[model samples]
Target: MLSRSSFLAVIATIAATNVVAAPFTYVNERFGTVCTFPDDIFTDRQPEPDNGDGQQWLSADGASLICSGILNIDDDTPKGFVAAEKASSEPGYKVTYSKASKDWAVLSGLKDGNIFYERRLFGRDGVIRTVWIEYPPAAKSKYDPLVGAIAGSLKAR
Candidate 1:
């Protein structure tokens, strides 16, 4: 038998849990894209930066990072995948996963002891939307779920 105050406390806890799990959208009209992120846990790395290219963000603890942009290249997802592959082919990058579809390209790898995940979505309007999230391998358990949520929330509008 729960007392009235105890029942109210339980309700409050549930409400807070729901709010903390809610996603927030990072929108850039210039890029014609929107990405979902965790609430109040990430801070914009470039709050006043130009939206022409994209936006960058950092975890509140600075242990993780995220960024997204739209490039002006007139190409399809294959081209974007090639570009991503080229970019990740740099000195210390070791690809852990890669996949390409008609509309999406993903390249994830471990570099310099850090984990990096990148995805590119091809828009029919000749715009390439790219997103990147990075965190130390040691922090993957904490950051992976949040990053995954953000990646899963990306959409072209």
Candidate 2:
């Protein structure tokens, strides 16, 4: 029941639809919102792997940096992680990685993407329990400092 032009126009529009890049949300709560981060602006990078380096994305404000490092649990530990932390109600190592944490909220895909492992720790009113989304160095070119900062600034509500 549609005209040829109308159908073509619809098809064209569909073809041209480019999904906007949404911000990657890692964590959010009464504490704060953590997302994809911006890197330090003062630093320089390799455009094409100069000296074996690679390219990276800069943050809008540019102070802290997010760089991908190798994903190795054997040789890595969570930053600012506390030996004793808390969750809804369980006795674990403070914070533990579970794709099914009620705390993650809608920050989905934290376990399905380049995030290799999630390091967890607990926080309280005036303390910090940091977590990490480990990825390879190649992915380091796309570090999410907002996410890191969120992990760095978490506390129990």
Candidate 3:
């Protein structure tokens, strides 16, 4: 019973509602690490840690995104970091895929039954900038496509 223009307007409104919002950039003051993510997906921003090392954001459905930096005290290279992650004893942590270059490393696999993707950049400032994103396996189709953009946005100042 709706007019043609009214029907089109309603459809447009619905489409707009389904669209994800623009991404937000977070920069770590201490280590100069930077990350970008869609804030609408990670709606709950947690309190910044006292050490000023990083920031974390959570979604309503249990997904989490962490942007952090750590001192490269051990002078670890990308390959060494990947090796260390693969050797981690953390319960339910398993690295199924890993790749490392001269200055960056990426690890993806299951962690506590959830899918996790992590990207780290070795900065010239003796800091390792990292972005870690994790979500339920059931939401792989939803989150997987967005991971690349989020991970690619990680950098160091």
Candidate lDDT scores, in order, read 0.64, 0.31, 0.85
Better of 1 and 2 by lDDT: 1
Q: In candidate 2, how many clashes are counted?
A: 3
Please list the Cα RMSD from the true structure of every candidate, rounded to 1 decimal place: 8.7, 17.3, 9.2
Off by over 4 Å in 1: 1-22, 72-76, 79-88
Stretches off by above 4 angstroms in model 3 are 1-18
Give the least accurate 10-residue stretch of model 2, judged by summed lDDT: 102-111
Clashes of each: 0, 3, 0
Instruction: Score residue 2 of candidate 2 by CA lDDT.
Output: 31
Please provide, for model 2 over 34-149, each residue's C-alpha lDDT reduced to its tens digit, 9 standing for 90 to 100: 32322233133325333321123433323222222222334322331222222223422223343323122112122223343343332223222233444433444434333333
What lDDT tens digits, residue by residue, belong to model 1 across residues 49-151?
6546667777655555454565656455655665667666578888778877888777788877788887777877777777788887777666665555556
Q: Of the candidates numbered 2 and 3, which has the greater lDDT value?
A: 3
